[model samples]
Structure formats: C-alpha cells, structure tokens
Target: MEEIFAICDDITILRDGQWVDTRPLEGLTMDSIISMMVGRELTQRFPEKSNVPKETILEVQHLTALNQPSIQDVSFELKAGEILGVAGLVGSKRTDIVETIFGVRERSEGKILLNGKEMRNRDAHEAINNGFALVTEERRSTGIYGNLDITFNSLVANVEEYKTKSGLLSNKKMKSDTQWVIDSMSVKTPGHETAIGSLSGGNQQKVIIGRWLLTQPEILMLDEPTRGIDVGAKFEIYQLILELAKKNKGIIIISSEMPELLGITDRILVMSNGRAAGVVETKNTTQTEILELASRYL
Candidate 1:
C-alpha cells in the first residue's frame, strides 16, 4: 500500500579526494524508474521489503542448517499493534531468534522486513536507527549499567540526542526524561540520582524498558521482560506492553512463562533448537502445542 523508498542519488561532489557529500540515501524505493537505474542489484538484496500491499511480514526464508538443533524452513508475518509471543524453554533458540532480530546475535540465513521492506543488516545500531528496539533478557549485564545512577542509566541510551554543545549531553534533558519514565512506569526510586544497585528487581526491569522506550522504536524486542520480577510488577509490565500495542508498536516478546504468553500475545511462536518450530493462533492453540514445539530441544 505504502511506497518505501531510499534516496541513493550520488552525483559525487568530490572525486576520490573526498571533500564533498558522499552520504547514501536513507530510504530507496524500487520503482520502474529505479529499475531502469540499476536493476542488476535486485539479485543482491534478494526480495526487497519496501512498501507493498500485503499482510505478510517479509518472511525470513532460509533453511535451518541440518547440523543445527531447531526447526527448518519456517516463516511468519507480524503486523502493527500485534503482540507476538515466542514461547520456549531455555536453549530452544527463542532468545536467539529475538536477539538476531535485534542484531545482538548473527543469523546465517533468512531475511527480516519492516512493513514489508527488507531490513538492512548493520548490527544493533542499524536496527535501532531503523526504528527497532530491544529489551535484553540479561538485563543486569546487557540492558543496564549497574554502576551508574538510575537517572543516568535510564537516559544513557538517548543521551546523544539531548546534546547541547559539541557532543556534550544536556544533563537537564536527561534528568527530565528519566523522571518522566519513572513516573509514567511508576518506578519506585529515590530520584534520578539513585544508584541502580539499590533498586528491586521489578523496579530495575522497569528502568530497562524505560531506557528502550526513550528510543521511540516502532518495533520492540523484549526478551524475558518479566522474568524474576514480582507479580504486581509483572502485571504492570503486561499493561505497559498492551499499551504499547494499542499505540501500534509491533512487539516480539520472548517469554518462558506459558500463562504470561497466553495472557498477552496476539499469536504464539514456538522455537526449537535454533528454528521456528511452529506458529499458532493464541486462542486456537493450547500450551500443549507449545510443549510439543519446544520438545525438539530434548
């Protein structure tokens, strides 16, 4: 329906010496005109993901290597405001799948698309730049910096955007944003200056989610977001996730808890080994299917 495009016109103001503009296009659309331009590179990117009238998610269609311990030749699509749950036991590759989507890990085959457009593989930074965010499972090690103050940690992911001078962050902006998230998420903290080491597990998890929300990603990858947190806090997180969906953010939640996934996801995906074992409608399927899908790891 919508046309996705990239601006790749390069007249090359500087020749070899590099004294002029050499930036590539941010978005390129492959139209009839564009097809006339190169048309040969189509084989390079394979099936492109920019702009189309389809309910498909630009499925990643690479087979799981025979040696790998997971499903093979699986594909699926996700839509805006949809909450998809990935349910599997530890080592089932659920986390690995989401991590690869967030660029924390690598994938040998398959493609990823946003709104039907092929996604660029530029690591986590590229994914974030293209409106994707990740809330890591290892929150303590990968998501948050325990040594920093709560306020600093909350805003560190977005400090550069609030820079006042030549790359120097504006502390005031950071403090205000951090405070906003704390209040919005109902985080229990002394203030922005509180050390992260002092917060409870639930509060700490809230901070991690808050950090990613500040990036304004359209699609959020959450890995074990509710793991090891209090029941009340878990409910709050579920509410937040639902709220995010209501706001039209595509969410991929990697959760080990079966009830939690049943309670939230629009659909469920089960991973085995490093493969997508199955994708089932939430209401039509039961936990039995989830168990069967995850059993491949056994």
Candidate 2:
C-alpha cells in the first residue's frame, strides 16, 4: 500500500475477479483502499503479539553451507513457542539460512542440535522425518504442484499418514484432510478437485501452509509467506503464525518486509553477506539498527 501510494498517481481496485473502481490517489487512505479491495473493513494491519517464548528447542552452532559465497558461520537459537524473523536486503542470502536448516542446501560445516541432541539433516526426506517443515520462497517452482488439484497438494507432504493396511492411498482420508485445509486456512476454492494453479496467490499460500501443518512438524520455516497477497490475507496469515507459536511450535520466517518482522517476531535475526550479522529483541530494536547489521559484513 505504501509503495503503491508513493509511486502510482492513480489506483485501480479489484474484488473477486471484478473491477471495483479506478481513481486518482489524491485524498485516499490505506484503510479506504483496503476496504474496497477485500470487501470488508480491516481494522488492524497486524494482530497483537500474544505468543510467549519457552525453553530453547533448536540451536545452530557455526552453521556453514557447502555452496561458495553462501551462508557461513551462521548461528541462532529458536525457542519453542517463539516467532523468529530473518531480515536482510536482497542477495543477502536470507533464504539460505532456512534452506540450509531444512536440508534443501547442503551444509559443509555446522552443528544442528534439536532438544540438545545432534541432528544431521543431509536431505529433504531426512529433514521431514526429523520433524522439520519448510515453505519455500518460490511457490510456483518449489512450494506447490500447480497442475495438481487441492486434494493432492494438501496431502502430498504427509501422504504416508493416509495409507491404509493394503498399502494404498485412501480416498476418504485424503478428502477429509483436504476439506480440513480449506476450512481451517479459509482457502477459497470451488471444490477439492479444483486445480491449485487457478486459485489466487493468497489461497495457494494458505493451502501450502496447511499442508505443512498436517505433518505436525516441530520446526516450521516460512520464506516470504505473505508475498503478493492482499492486506486481509496477510493479516490472517499473521494470526495463524501466532496461533501456531502458542502451540509451542518453533517458527522461523524470512521476509523482506521490515514492518512485518517488527510486527510479528519476538526476535529479529539480521543477515549480512550470507552470515548471521546479529540478533536483537524485536521490541528493543529499530529498523535502522537492523539495516545497519544487515550491511555489517558487506
């Protein structure tokens, strides 16, 4: 909204695949624009922080990836029931941190400890078995099966659970879980057989997140979770994250939006040149300090 109001002189509003209004930006406020776009009055941009941090559940000690010019000697601890935000500029390798932890990227040298025990996540399969789930940055390329239906996309990550004694996938279980995703995440879809590619970006993201939740992971890492979504959708995602944190799930979010980090996370981990620059309490740190640390190792 800020960027649109700043750069564009005129604005066009769309609602439910139909055009709402097109008018000049003069005398227009964010609330007015958002109301028009979502067809509802959104009172808050972000939900209030309510999750309380608990004992440490994950520790990354001197983590380094195999790829050259990537994350090196990065370290941080995530406590159960906490929301940890990763913030950095473009090309800072913010996504690499979660990828490395999730075993999407190999770690050349590092120590990952879960519940005070060493964990070797050498591959994505191993990471999933170790109770770790990641929602990748590129939804089209890595997150969802665009051509597949909602039923397939929602149950793909945890398909093993839907198997019957005959070693075949159960259609009844699949339909039940898919319906749960739609209802719990508020995903708008005509039916479970609807192709995921036809849904909007926000609905696709919600389906992906719901899919991960079905796995019951101990650690959840989201990369740009709310990107390209409307304001109402972003607010719902934020509330969902907070709700998960209250359940004692450790969540790590990587976002380019600074206000989002400040609004949702308990602590902000600033990355610089593929390294862990610094970690600050979100309540005590400002955007200026985060930006300063982001450029520290440049």
Candidate 3:
C-alpha cells in the first residue's frame, strides 16, 4: 500500500491523528512517500528489467476454463526473461485466466504449450511438476499455512523433492532449503520456527514467494504480489521479480495496479469482460491507452 497523499493547490498528509506535512505536488513521486512519513531511508531502488524478449517458452491458445465461460478465447505467448502483466477490472476473470493456465482451474478447451510441447495439467501438482509455480492472489485464505511455522510454509511446495527413496522426508534438506529462501528473499522473522501468522503482511508475502520459488519453476505466475504491503516492501518484491527475470524465467504478473504493472512488465495483456482486448508494449503505452483497451469488452 502507498501512503495517501492529497493534492490540490497544496498536498497534505494525514498521519497519527494529525496533519503531518503539506506541500506543493510539484516534483513529487510515489517513491518519496516512505521517507516523508516513516522517517526511514529506502536504501535500494528497484532494478531495471530488459525489454528484449528471448525465445517463447509458453503459449496459450484459444483457452477456456471448465464451468467458467467468462474466460473465453484467451491466448498469449510468454518469452524467457520477459515479464507479462495482466490487467482488468473487477469480475473481469483475470484470476480465472492464470488459474486455468497453472492447472488449478480446469481447462475445457485449449492448448498449453511449453517449449512447443503440449501439456495437460490436470491438477496443481501436475503444474508444479511441469516446472510451473503459482502464487495465488489470496494469501491467508488459499496460499499459506497460517498456523504452521516458516520452515513448513516455505518448503511445502517442493516437499516431494526432499523425499528419500524410502518415501520419508529429509528434515535436514528441508531446513537447508528453507534457510536459502529466507536469506535469498530476505524474509524477516525471529526464527524459521516462528509461526507464519505472527509476521507482518509484507514478510508473509515474501515467505509465500519463497515457497513457490523452491519448486524450481520455469514459469512463475504471481497474482497481486503487493496487494496489502507498504511501498518499501513493494520495491523489494519488484527487485525480486527482476532478479527472477535475470535467471531467464518467464514471469506472468496479474495486478490491479496500473502503475505497478506498467512500471515492471515488458508487455501487458489487457483483459476486458473476459477476452484478450489487446497486448501492448509497456515502453510505448500509457495508462490511458491501457484503460481504454481494458474497458473494450465491458
């Protein structure tokens, strides 16, 4: 979440039951909100991702989800190291599109090709096994094991990878892998044994992303990665996304925020009512143009 700044002839900030600061909106950016309000310096800016897409790694053709006719005739291609953004209004079936591609929502008619080979993923496990990972939009309700500790939550997605030939889990490998994610993702907690529910929303999100990364996915789909977090955490998540792209992974992000999607993605797939309205290059497109296409089918 960003700090709410009001603009008129002057800008005003309301914080802690009092008006904190008021200034002209001139020369202001969303980036400065953290320091002006929280009294902490944001040390790192988000890294830039390259726009030149590589080989096409995933293709969805004329896809339709079972029992969900709203997702009709959806098609797109994602290249290695490219960040694709999906945007639409509420009830636009944005979530349904990603879930169908990741195999959580059944596909009634469509073809999913990974490296030119057709994949029929009947369930989430099959998707994971096919080198795909999905970080669902709803974290507390559907993504995480709230009562479980950080270790369990972090390693749960790749549990099968740590199983021995005898079919027993290797706790040592699990803890080691979990530590790597904590260090890599910078997930803050008192200890890895701490309950996931005890952490703040941002850290919880980091843990959720870490869990999906453990699956060693070639395609990573994130639905609203920064929904309820502060701006600082959002920057961190953006950096993580760039880092993933640096590894040549295909990243598909479904976000409601136009700026966030336009800022980070290479190309955007604007959905309207339930169909693919347009796919625009992020570098050349404006929010006005995106919104126009987003409302086409509505």
Candidate 4:
C-alpha cells in the first residue's frame, strides 16, 4: 500500500554492472530485497501482498499471483555518509511506515531487521533498545518534554545508563552530558540547566534530537525532521543528520518537501496508498518524479 511505500527510503540502482557514485544511497531498498525481506519472490510473491495479511504465507502467495502492487522491480541500498528521503503528499501513509518501524505504530505482518538482526514488536522501548530512534513529525507532542529541564529532557531516552551506583541519577554527570550535547549539536539555549519550555522551537527540537542521540542508535527514523525550524536551524540539523549517516548510521527521513530530500538524500523513496509507489536514485530522480508519485494519492 501507499502508506508503506510513501515513507520507504529508495534503494540504489545498478546499470551496466557498476555502482553509481554521486552520493551514497541511504536507507535504500530493492524490490527483490524487500520481498525477500518478507520471505517472498520479487514479482510473483510481491504485487498482491501490498497490504500484507497476518495469516498464512500460502494466502499471501495466492494474492501475489494477482500482481496487485504492479510497480516494476526496483532496488537500491544506502551508503554511509548520506541521507535517504521518504516523500509523499499528505494521506499517503509515509508517516505510518516510519512510525511502525519505530514501534510507535504496530507492524502486524512484516519482519523488521536492524543491523541484520530481526526486531520484535514490543514498544518504543524495545525499538530504542535495538538502537532505533524516531524524531517524529509532531515534535511538540511526540519528541519534546516541555516541562522538564534541558538535562532531564535530554537524558530521558538514555537514562538507564546514567543511573548512579545507588540507583539515583547523578545530576552532575547528567548535566555534563547535557552540556556536551548542547555544545556538539550547536543548540542555542540560555543554559543546559534551563527549562526546555523557555527555549525557542528550534532549540526544543534540538533537545529532542539530542535525547535520541544519547541512546547511540544505529538507525534513526526522522519523520518531518526539520518541518517548522528556521532555515539556519534546518541547515544545522541537516548537517547533523549527514554526520550520523557518514558514521554508517542508516537514516530514514520523511518530509513533505522534495528539495530537502533531493538536496540531501542519496535517493528518494516515493510512497503512495500505503505502499511504495516508486523509488528513484538521487542522481537520477528529479522533482518531477516526486510529483508523479505524489499525484497517485490525489
């Protein structure tokens, strides 16, 4: 369905037996790989299985025989040091896919593998424990802790590691860590001891991102990561995302803006109707292709 594909990060493409070299692909997916990821064949077992059922594989096989998805066989992979953009118009289900992967939404029928290990559908805690983090689109309600101090909010995701020998939090170390994140992420704040509520929208978003980074995630899912922040702040956040990818952290970014994806990501995944509509390599994909994909939902 459009929901899933709309948020998918595109896979790298190979032509004439050589890898494309412009920007390394990020959070890329191959058709065969995606299908195989679900234990099915590329074409025969893929099409009709878009809205994957929770029952027997045989039933799924019967559906795939109908070729429901109907998209061509496409594939790509993301390289370290690059971003992968997932784009679509509203109602295309892009956010749904990202949320499901982050455990904010349930995944009733697919296997989620992180760093080659299968993931369990427990809760957001399990997702974080497996080194996955999401900076959701609704930042105010989802990512921030407005009433908490800078240090408290930044330490929320990774608090277990900061517990003292007596099981009490070490306020000193916590402050030190918060200070470090603020300095490193270039977050503008009166003080790391100040309330997150006192900061501007940009600063608040930075705190949320900082908190997720505290967990040292291997894969980061950012849905509309830079929506309302100012242009300068957006650039800074983009830089941070780039650095993480360069360090080999797989990043999946969902945004309404096409240029953001085309400008920063190595490839763009086009989602519509709860499934991937199409995928384009950043070097090969244009804003027009994105428009075409977004048009499907209309």
Which candidate gets the maximum lDDT versus the true structure?
Answer: 2
The candidate scoring highest on TM-score is: 2
Give candidate 1's TM-score: 0.75
Error of 3 at 197 (Å): 0.8
lDDT-better candidate, 2 vs 4: 2
- Per-residue lDDT over 1-298 for candidate 2, one digit per residue giving the tens place of the 0 to 100 score: 6898879999999765569999899999988999998889998888999999999999999999998889999999999999999999899999989889989899999999989988899988899989899999999998889999999999999989989999999988899999999999999999999999988888899999999999989999999999988887899899999999999999999999999999999999999999889999999999999999999989
lDDT of 1 by residue, 76-194 (tens): 67777788889877777676666666665656667778766788645888888878888888888887788788887788777667987777777778778988889888888878888
Task: Give the C-alpha miss distance for residue 223 in model 2, angstroms.
Answer: 0.4
The 10 consecutive residues of candidate 3 with the worst lDDT sum are: 1-10
lDDT for each candidate structure: 0.71, 0.93, 0.86, 0.66
- Candidate 2 regions exceeding 4 Å error are 1-10
Worst 10 residues of 4 by lDDT: 56-65
Off by over 4 Å in 1: 1-59, 63-74, 296-298
What does the lDDT read for residue 53 in candidate 2? 96
**Residues 1-298 of candidate 3: C-alpha lDDT, one tens digit per residue:** 2233442445665432246698776677765656664346776544566545799999999999888556999999999999999998888899998899888888889999999999888889999999899988998999888999999999988888899999999989988988987999998788889999988777899999999988889999999999887666788899899889889999999999998987899999999988999999998999999989988987
lDDT of 4 by residue, 1-298 (tens): 3444466455443322234333223443455443433234334310111111121111000001112232222223434444668887777777766666667665445556543456773589988998878888888887787887888888888988888899998878888889988988887777877888777677788788888898998777788887876444566677777777656677778888776887677668787656566677776888888889877755
| Of candidates 3 and 1, the better by TM-score | 3
In model 1, how large is the Cα lDDT of residue 211?
87
How displaced is residue 65 in candidate 2, in Å? 0.4
